[model samples]
Target: MLFENQRVTPSVSGAGEFMKAALEGAEAIVLAQSSMEELVKVHKICRRRPGMKLLLHLDSMKGLSKTPEAVSFLAGYIKPDALITSSPQAAVEARRHGITSVLRCFAFDEESIDSSLKLIERANPDYVQVVPGVIPVTIRLMRAKTGLPVLAGGLVRTDADVCRAEKAGATGITSSCPDLWQAAYVSRAKRS
Candidate 1:
């Protein structure tokens, strides 16, 4: 899985390294590709690669925010096991349509948080991810309200952040920073 800051240009070594970094220590992964075509390529690679669990995130980083073509591209490519989106409305629609949906609560402010919570409760996604900007209390409240798995994301630059979030009830973390997976794997091992 990629992050907001991860590189997305096509290159042999870069692609392999990206896959390796993203998949190596991840128990479950969410590939945030830049475009539909890139997403498809990642899916193919993930299908071929062993071990790491895969979740295709419909993160519209380099593409349109949310469009029919975007939705169709994601739905068609890879038959995603889980779909991630920032909009509660989209998440609800995805769930209504019977996909194992995941939502990223990109709550930059109180209003956004409220909106996201309303959406989360309304749609009841399989997972509700809180971006790194979201506070611990917000994560718990969202979990309590929606009764869904909570994943923390955004600006997670360190392992400590992952552990702290997990301790605070996050089910997982999303980050483009290369060190997170190894750090989290080690942390998970210690806890186990």
Candidate 2:
């Protein structure tokens, strides 16, 4: 339940996007495609919205070393609630620092899926994020193989895509589209 009851977590790269998502009622957000310099501004925005959960995507971040010390710094200083990374070492380090770790895997074909499963076993992360999440079969396969909550990301442009991912057993979906964010909140409100 990393995102709690929210099914869609906005993937944002800047302070503006973060603020907009927060205003749009996002409970959690993945900070991706961002730089080290932007952390301060994002952290300031986060402090204003203490209830929001922040996740830093290590691979997508610029000028941040993918090392244990870097993970420690992020956990201690930046204070993100979770860490998303493609590196097993980074994921392990995040867990060592008592931060939630999400292992990001790109599943383009059967070979990639098999390899990703092996990586997941070794990383032992808190969650697994499968890229190009439109593939329901891959989502189901990853969930079944890992026995961990799976987050579907990338190419999830429409509500139908979100529905497909959820029906396929995805615990949550991450998207950069603002329209999708509003749609998800509206859908959640309707359900409530």
The local distance difference test score of each candidate is: 0.58, 0.86
**Per-residue alpha-carbon lDDT of model 2 for 33-122, expressed as tens digits?**
998877778888879876778889888889897788899899889888899998899999999988999999999899999999989998
Model 2 regions more than 4 Å off: 186-192
Write model 1 residue lDDT over 37-151, tens digit each, in one string.
5655666766876643445566554554554355555556555556678766566656655556777777666897788877777667777778752367767766776777777
Q: Give per-model CA RMSD.
A: 5.6, 1.6
Instruction: Give me the candidate number with maximum TM-score.
Output: 2
Candidate 1, which segments miss by more than 4 Å at Cα?
1-14, 50-52, 61-65, 96-98, 183-187, 190-192
Q: RMSD to the native, candidate 1?
A: 5.6
Q: Would you list the clashing residue pairs of candidate 2?
A: none
- In terms of TM-score, how similar is model 1 to the real structure? 0.74
Clashes of each: 2, 0
Q: How accurate is candidate 1 locally (lDDT)?
A: 0.58
